[model samples]
Target: MAWLVSTPSRKDDTGDRLFLEVAAEAARNERIRAIYLDVRAQAFANISRAFAGLMGSDAVSDEHRALAQAFMLIELGSVCARTLLNEPVQPASDRLIECLVGMPV
Candidate 1:
């Protein structure tokens, strides 16, 4: 999956705006919050699929599910930190990717 390595160049993060918008809406709007929760579950499923693809497995393994959940949390944190600081996700995101490679999933 492209998302596995889809970190944008720092200056070209066009997705950040929409991410912030969704984050704000989820914080205050109950309907959007529910939808966002569903979206997050879907994201986790998507990530599991991606990880399975990487492993050349047709089904997502337990290890894949664990790694996907961890990676999702890291990604969400990276986005939040970037939006709050008005900066690019950097070394932290890079570091997370590195961890993924070494992880046994």
Candidate 2:
């Protein structure tokens, strides 16, 4: 992964460089994988809640509904990627849950 990102053409791209660095670092640490798993779980939960809310709102237009569905699909991809990494499932932060659900923290 890092090798792909470190290609000559992409070597100067800060985002690619950062991604390579992070991937290398994560590869060396089990804790980073666990942290990523938690974050991805929270993201998936938030996206699911947002999708449900959008689907239930009568005020939302068909176009917006489609967009929301697309967003949910993207989040699902993230969830799948995290699952593939085989990170242990852990409880998500309360702050993340509250922010995602729009509930008082």
Hey, what RMSD does candidate 2 come out at? 14.9
Question: Best-fitting candidate, measured by lDDT?
Answer: 1
Instruction: Give the worst 10-residue stretch by lDDT in candidate 1.
Output: 5-14
Alpha carbon deviation, residue 44, candidate 2 (Å): 0.6
The runs of at least 3 residues in candidate 2 whose Cα sits more than 4 Å from the true structure, single-residue gaps closed, are 1-24, 57-105
| Candidate 1 ranges beyond 4 A from true positions | 8-14
For each candidate, what TM-score against the reference? Answer: 0.76, 0.36
